[model samples]
Target: MNSSIFTPVSPTINTSLKPHQNPLILIDNKRVACARARKHVTRTKALFSTTKEIVLKEFHQRRALKIISGLQNLDKYDVASVVIAADKGGATHVDIACDPELVKLATSLTSLPVCVSSVDPAAFPAAVEAGAVMVEIGNYDSFYDMGLTFSPEQILSLTKETKTMLPTVTLSVTVPHTLSLPDQVKLAQQLEQEGVDIIQTEGGKFSNPSKAGVLGLIEKASPTLAAAYSISRAVNIYVMCSSGLSSVTAPMAITAGASGVGVGSAVNKLNDVVAMIAQVKSIAESLNLSTIEEVVFEESNLRL
Candidate 1:
């Protein structure tokens, strides 16, 4: 990590994402700060060690999918339905409320990494104990209706506070869309400095798509894609582009520079697990389009 966490790392040509890619990250005088990030992330692999390799492989491929069951959703059946769909549909992970019992429930339902989302730092430790593979600090959309907002300073302070409480667990903090793009960039840098493993960007609720059909879909995803494009370029870690994303714009998220994407309503808003899984598979297929296109390209070149 560089002294300035928000600065770009040595940009490597990402022509492909390999299943067994090496995890070694080299640090020069430029990124001495990220040295600790490399060390701690490795040490903390126990949480998702079972699926870490695949999760990261998909991330590097820019296809890792995280199914969200809603931060405000508490009905066990509803959460469980999404968890089942996520596992069956090939998501890299699942996110639910910060409730410990739900964490346990979600974990039992699927072997995929179980990420718990919350704004409350106090809710994390117990959830971690209950088998949460990763802990997240923002899903601010849930609070938007209540007329609440999380300022950049408040989010950063909460991140620092969460770090103090659980130093070794994988921590993912969301950069509130409520902040200006420049402020979002600054906060993401500070979060990188804080050793956060993943930075999530959200903009679904805030974006009001006035257009209809595909145009509307793109309109909805524009904010987060803008964030992903800017932040992924600036930071040296995974950026989970989320909010208002659909199959059409999902591939755009990765192309825009996100390592993975957090999807909520696309799956959660569905009425049943079957529909949820179908949505999940649709997304998985979309994200897999790059690999498919590459294979076809190689085959065509051979034929030529």
Candidate 2:
């Protein structure tokens, strides 16, 4: 073995350095900083679970399905039905109102990862402690009906505060559809810079579709799809296109560049759990078919 392989080279001495500016000490400090960085990364990775791994894998494959039971929904029976439907219908995870009891109920009902949603940063810790592996900072559909809108600055502030509260928990922040598409993209970029793991898009309630059937479904999903397309391209993080999505438009969401889709009313509005499960299954199948079709097209291109 070469002696150089085991030897440490002395850094060049700088004559401009003050007495306190020791080069060796600076090198040691750098090593310490690097070690601290590695430790942070390790700690962050340690937060992942087998369920989270599966959900993330689905996102990477652009087939992730998240069933949302609604952020304001406090009805235990309704939330429980949604959670069960999400699991039986093959959804990657289920998102419910951020309550410790709801989190516990969701986790107990299914093997899928449970994500809690709330606007309150302080409420997340308790839900995470109760069993929610992921936390979402906004699910503002109900708020929209109440004439509340979150500005981009407000969202960025919320993201910062949420991160401070749960630095290691996987965070997904919604880019409010109230903003113009350009503003949405800008906010998503800022959220990504804040270390947010996922960016969710919403606009279902704002849309007013004139036509019925498939045309109406496409129109209803347009705002969120557009947001997904713009924001997904602007940031490296995952974009979950949500709000007003149906089986007809869930696949379209993937083509628009979302890593996943979140369905709320479409799955949660049904009175019967069986109907909820059927809706979830329909959306899930649409996403899977979309994935398969894309794969075939890519393979065909390779052959040519």
Candidate 3:
């Protein structure tokens, strides 16, 4: 609920983005991010894998993984299947609908933290009561499919209202990737002032790459990546780069300034559980190590 929550757990490192130390603490214990991490070696090919046994214990060091089942998805069986895959695949957490029943079901299936997504500020309290560790107010992709879009003011107002209702709960607000880059940065700063704990950026829904293969994939991830790079420098809170992200873009998000990434559709859309787990492992591995040393923090607070 407060900035102090992340201070003790996340370690500090210098980034080329600036000479000064940047805040690395992203999620705290409230998000059920208390997973213990240890490095182990595989004898098969002399490979080293840093297993994400528990991520909450060290989410800041490694990019946190959140596999979402979708905000509008109400089917418990479908949601449970995704939850099972997320856990078996070594994901740090799972995101599901705000329904208390779904929350309960997800909790029953996995030890990971459950994050409930809903635009209705009122829906959060009950989900929080039902065992959701974190509450997200935006997963704009689902709403956009229905021709609904939120204004900057509306998102800020929702945050204020949600914060009032659940003052002590860990809250993450999404900056609608639909907004212009300048507008998104402005909105991110405002959310921080409102005491929003984490800011999630989304752009996959807006991007439709023209080319095929890697070029297309990068184009698809461009929206969120651009927003992540610009917004992370302006705010001192946790930035989650999500949407249109794949194993290819996951590492790019972390290097861009996001303390972590939230991957939906990419993992959940797959029909096979093994495929879903493989995708999760691929994305998690991308965040395990990065060559980008410095992330320049540029403060550009444009007005909303």
Candidate 4:
């Protein structure tokens, strides 16, 4: 909650893929080009390889929902149920904590990509060996309650060290939302430079924002949303907006330019897994529409 760090303004548009610079944009295999004369022809083989091979190389295609089980003792049935809920709810991936049994069980139970969350650098390699598709450097919200703090330098160093050790595994580093927004942005840029694949923002600790009403919810989530907006713009990697998020603010995150989102308490806190999945799907649909509408409006404005 540093006032000085909130100085940067949010971007008016998502700048990940600029249309003017890359005029030949492809959508579902069809080329949408403004001028035939400006077209840069390529071999069909090259196009096919670029398209199909790229998809095949990645772990998953959709924005993911990483379910974290809050069960006291990690049980196979509980892990299985969460995975089932995630799959049925349309999650592209699931993230479990740094437990070996849960990692093995979750991987065996589902086809979706799995991620492991651990603060220890030593545990990352073992988590990867246990079949985690990605390794997250945090769940900092949990640590914040214990009066712990993570510095940008430590995050950058860990990222470099982690990448050096686990070269092939995808890495998602959480930008400690507890830090000032500028520090968050700086760390995000550093992580990107360190070759981290995904950046996630969280805002549940340091102080819990009230969840009583609309205004209260916004108050609670503004920090994470601001982090999402600033960090996503500063870095080229995917940013998963998280913490204090609900169905209402999901689209807001997308409009602010998050490539994805991760919800733990919102889903795990619920007693009914089916209802949780439905709510998560509703939020996902809202984000999908928001992204499409933004793209369409940008395309239309370009035509004008």
Per-residue CA lDDT of candidate 4, range 204-269, in tens?
554466557877777777878888999878987788887877777766777787877777777766
By lDDT, rank the candidates, best first.
2, 1, 3, 4
**Per-candidate alpha-carbon RMSD to the true structure:** 16.3, 10.4, 19.4, 20.1
Best by TM-score: 2
Q: In model 3, what lDDT does residue 276 have?
A: 83
- Better model by lDDT: candidate 1 vs candidate 4: 1
Q: CA lDDT of 102 in candidate 2?
A: 88
- Against the reference, the lDDT scores of all candidates come to 0.85, 0.88, 0.80, 0.70
Backbone clashes in model 2 = 0
- For model 1, residues 1-304, the per-residue Cα lDDT tens digits are 3353322333362323234333243224326767778877776665456444544666776667999998889999999999999998878889999999999899889988888999889989999889886889988887998999998788888999998998877788999999889889899999999989889999988899999999999999999999999999899999999999999999899999998999999999899789999999888888884456568899999999
Scored against the true structure, residue 69 in model 3 reaches a CA lDDT of 93
- Residue lDDT tens for model 3, 82-150: 999888776777889899999989989998888899999999989988888788988878778889999
Instruction: Locate the minimum summed-lDDT window of 10 residues in model 2.
Output: 2-11
- Model 4: weakest 10-residue lDDT segment is 20-29
Which pairs of residues clash in candidate 3, taking residues 3 or more apart in a chain or in different chains? 15-294, 16-294, 16-295, 17-295, 17-296, 33-56, 34-56, 35-54
Sliding window of 10 residues with minimal summed lDDT for model 1: 13-22
- TM-score ranking, best first: 2, 1, 3, 4
Q: Which stretches of candidate 1 lie over 4 Å from their true place?
A: 1-57, 289-304
- For each candidate in turn, the TM-score is 0.78, 0.80, 0.76, 0.70
